[model samples]
Target: MFESIKNLFKKEEVFPCIIFDGKIMKYLDLTQKQIDKLQEENKDWTITKKEEC
Candidate 1:
Protein backbone atom coordinates (compact mmCIF):
# COMPACT_ATOMS: atom_id res chain seq x y z
CA MET A 1 0.00 0.00 0.00
CA PHE A 2 2.78 2.41 0.99
CA GLU A 3 4.79 1.46 -2.10
CA SER A 4 1.90 2.26 -4.36
CA ILE A 5 1.31 5.58 -2.60
CA LYS A 6 4.98 6.47 -2.90
CA ASN A 7 4.95 5.59 -6.56
CA LEU A 8 2.05 7.95 -7.07
CA PHE A 9 4.16 10.83 -5.75
CA LYS A 10 7.26 9.84 -7.66
CA LYS A 11 8.83 12.45 -9.89
CA GLU A 12 9.59 11.78 -13.51
CA GLU A 13 13.24 11.55 -14.51
CA VAL A 14 14.78 14.08 -16.87
CA PHE A 15 17.98 14.30 -18.82
CA PRO A 16 19.97 17.50 -19.10
CA CYS A 17 21.50 18.74 -22.31
CA ILE A 18 23.60 21.63 -23.50
CA ILE A 19 23.05 23.24 -26.86
CA PHE A 20 25.70 25.48 -28.34
CA ASP A 21 26.40 26.56 -31.87
CA GLY A 22 23.83 24.10 -33.23
CA LYS A 23 25.45 21.25 -31.31
CA ILE A 24 23.65 19.22 -28.69
CA MET A 25 25.51 17.53 -25.86
CA LYS A 26 23.51 15.23 -23.64
CA TYR A 27 24.41 14.24 -20.13
CA LEU A 28 23.56 10.91 -18.51
CA ASP A 29 22.28 12.71 -15.43
CA LEU A 30 22.49 16.27 -14.18
CA THR A 31 20.99 17.97 -11.15
CA GLN A 32 19.27 21.36 -11.21
CA LYS A 33 22.23 22.95 -9.45
CA GLN A 34 24.63 21.59 -12.02
CA ILE A 35 22.43 22.81 -14.85
CA ASP A 36 22.27 26.28 -13.31
CA LYS A 37 26.00 26.34 -12.86
CA LEU A 38 26.54 25.39 -16.47
CA GLN A 39 24.14 28.07 -17.62
CA GLU A 40 25.95 30.63 -15.54
CA GLU A 41 29.30 29.57 -16.88
CA ASN A 42 28.15 29.60 -20.48
CA LYS A 43 25.87 32.53 -20.94
CA ASP A 44 25.73 32.07 -24.69
CA TRP A 45 24.86 28.38 -24.50
CA THR A 46 21.45 26.90 -23.76
CA ILE A 47 20.51 24.37 -21.10
CA THR A 48 17.46 22.21 -21.57
CA LYS A 49 15.68 19.45 -19.68
CA LYS A 50 14.25 16.46 -21.50
CA GLU A 51 11.86 14.07 -19.78
CA GLU A 52 12.81 10.44 -20.02
CA CYS A 53 9.68 8.39 -20.40
Candidate 2:
Protein backbone atom coordinates (compact mmCIF):
# COMPACT_ATOMS: atom_id res chain seq x y z
CA MET A 1 0.00 0.00 0.00
CA PHE A 2 2.77 2.40 0.92
CA GLU A 3 4.65 1.51 -2.23
CA SER A 4 1.55 2.13 -4.34
CA ILE A 5 1.12 5.53 -2.73
CA LYS A 6 4.77 6.33 -3.40
CA ASN A 7 4.33 5.36 -7.01
CA LEU A 8 1.29 7.60 -7.33
CA PHE A 9 3.27 10.51 -5.92
CA LYS A 10 6.15 9.79 -8.27
CA LYS A 11 3.87 10.32 -11.26
CA GLU A 12 3.29 13.93 -10.29
CA GLU A 13 5.31 16.93 -11.53
CA VAL A 14 6.64 19.43 -9.02
CA PHE A 15 7.77 23.04 -9.21
CA PRO A 16 10.95 23.83 -7.36
CA CYS A 17 10.41 27.36 -6.17
CA ILE A 18 8.45 30.60 -6.14
CA ILE A 19 10.60 33.68 -5.81
CA PHE A 20 9.22 36.87 -4.27
CA ASP A 21 11.42 39.81 -3.51
CA GLY A 22 14.75 38.15 -2.69
CA LYS A 23 13.38 35.00 -1.09
CA ILE A 24 12.68 31.57 -2.54
CA MET A 25 9.71 29.45 -1.52
CA LYS A 26 9.21 25.84 -2.46
CA TYR A 27 5.91 24.58 -3.85
CA LEU A 28 4.89 21.17 -5.08
CA ASP A 29 2.30 22.26 -7.63
CA LEU A 30 0.57 25.57 -8.28
CA THR A 31 -1.26 26.95 -11.31
CA GLN A 32 -0.14 30.15 -13.02
CA LYS A 33 -3.60 31.69 -12.61
CA GLN A 34 -3.51 31.14 -8.86
CA ILE A 35 -0.14 32.75 -8.58
CA ASP A 36 -1.24 35.68 -10.70
CA LYS A 37 -4.32 36.13 -8.57
CA LEU A 38 -2.23 36.17 -5.42
CA GLN A 39 0.11 38.76 -6.90
CA GLU A 40 -2.78 40.91 -8.00
CA GLU A 41 -4.54 40.75 -4.64
CA ASN A 42 -1.36 41.39 -2.72
CA LYS A 43 -0.09 44.21 -4.85
CA ASP A 44 -0.64 46.71 -2.10
CA TRP A 45 0.77 44.47 0.61
CA THR A 46 4.48 44.29 1.30
CA ILE A 47 5.84 40.82 0.71
CA THR A 48 9.56 40.39 1.08
CA LYS A 49 9.58 36.63 0.62
CA LYS A 50 7.82 34.06 -1.49
CA GLU A 51 5.01 31.83 -0.26
CA GLU A 52 4.74 28.13 -0.90
CA CYS A 53 1.55 26.15 -1.27
TM value for model 2: 0.32
What is candidate 2's lDDT per residue for 1-53, written digit by digit as tens?
Answer: 99988897664333444545435443434455555566688674322223433
Among these predicted structures, which one has the highest lDDT? 1
lDDT of 1 by residue, 11-48 (tens): 76555554453476555466766777878888877666
Kindly report which residue stretches of model 1 are placed more than 4 angstroms away from their true locations once superposed: 1-15, 21-24
Residue 37 error for model 2, in Å?
A: 0.4
TM-score of each: 0.47, 0.32
Q: What is the Å distance of residue 28 in model 1 from its true position?
A: 3.7
In order, the Cα lDDT scores of the candidates are: 0.65, 0.49
How badly does each model clash, as a count of residue pairs?
0, 0
Error of 2 at 45 (Å): 6.6
**Distance from true location, Cα of 47 in model 2, Å:** 9.1
Clashes counted in candidate 1 amount to: 0
